[model samples]
Target: MKKLILVLVLVMGVFFSGNAQKVPTSEEIAKKNIEEMDKRLKLTPTQRSVIYNYAFDMAKEQLLLYKKQVAGTAKEEDETRIYRLQNEMNKNIKLVLKPDQIDEFNKLNEERLSGIDPGKKKKKKKKGEEEEKVVGIEGLKSTGNN
Candidate 1:
């Protein structure tokens, strides 16, 4: 009957939509970002390898803390874990980089955080359309002109 066909279609749509929304793991995100940085910075092979390992470890620790927080762990416990991981990551980074390379690495990370990229062109908004901006606690606002 048509009812059965309609039900099957609806079920299939729901299943596919859910599959499409799968989020990447933190490790996957870190690896992707590290690869992007390597391409942008033109890092040497040795530096790339070292940076990849560093990013992986840092991301893994962060992901663990995030999982705990999401699982309703106490805020204090999450903060403590994050603080300890940050200290360890900082110490490891210092050990991995040479004096000169450390400066370059820091600069690269800063640029990445700032979203500065020569290869990416900023899109211009149409008249009467403004860039969407996020306000602290207030959520997102649509500007009339961007």
Candidate 2:
């Protein structure tokens, strides 16, 4: 969910930019995340709790990392750590959610991450478990050998 992180960053950026009278607390952030996820995923009570815990933990880490960055003390490792937190959360979420739910989640998730700059070329990034798409243009697969 790059879109998830991008939305988070944009929201936080806006809040920190003087629009918000006071910074939101960790619990507030977690509650917002849970509400948004609940609306999108239609999570059951159990799924909601599990996701709430996971999202809360990630939010905490993100908040701490953000504070460090604002203080001009965060390292590159901190950035990587946030990425890991997001990836880890997604993995755990998949373990709890049904396959259909995962698909729906992914589809809705993409809607938020769309609209990249028109001038830039697209780059594909795959995680460990994701497979690369194969297009047959009279390639070996076209011969039908499993």
Candidate 3:
């Protein structure tokens, strides 16, 4: 009976822990972003400071948007706004980077963008199937006549 209770408690703990996610604070997000940039672009102290400021502001904006979305109060334009926010951050970061670092930064951006799908799925056409054209009322009338 003790073993059964222990197993049950362990399973319950795992189930609850698996569903909980902790959101990062703005500072944490900014620190992470600059760390990645430092690793990839070899940023100097001045560049890191400027980029961290940009990243922190972007992260705060993103967190606000995320909260609104979770509360079901987000506008349709909020989706586009997130992209605009990131673009602004990228532009500011580019200004602080050297010419060579800018090339590496662009490549990183491309790699990140490539992973996202545009939320569109094209319908697949079957083999030997011709595309269908819409017929107007006049054309339908002509086809109905023997």
Highest-scoring model, lDDT: 2
Candidate 1 stretches with Cα past 4 Å from truth are 1-20, 98-100, 111-146
Note the Cα lDDT for every prediction shown: 0.57, 0.72, 0.66
The 10 consecutive residues of candidate 2 with the worst lDDT sum are 137-146
lDDT of 1 at 96: 68
Of candidate 3, the 10-residue stretch with the lowest lDDT total is: 1-10
- lDDT string for model 1 (22-138, tens) is 644657756775777666556678877887777677666655655564477747656565566655655676576677766765676555334355355667889999676766543
- The numbered model that scores best in TM-score is 2
Q: Is candidate 2 or 3 superior in lDDT? A: 2
Over all chains combined, what TM-score does candidate 3 have?
A: 0.63
Report the Cα lDDT for residue 110, model 3: 59
RMSD values for the candidates in order, in angstroms, are: 13.6, 12.9, 18.1
Q: How many residue pairs collide in each prediction?
A: 2, 0, 0
TM-score for each predicted model, relative to the true structure: 0.53, 0.70, 0.63
Greater TM-score among 1 and 3 belongs to 3
lDDT of 3 by residue, 100-129 (tens): 999988776554444322233545769998
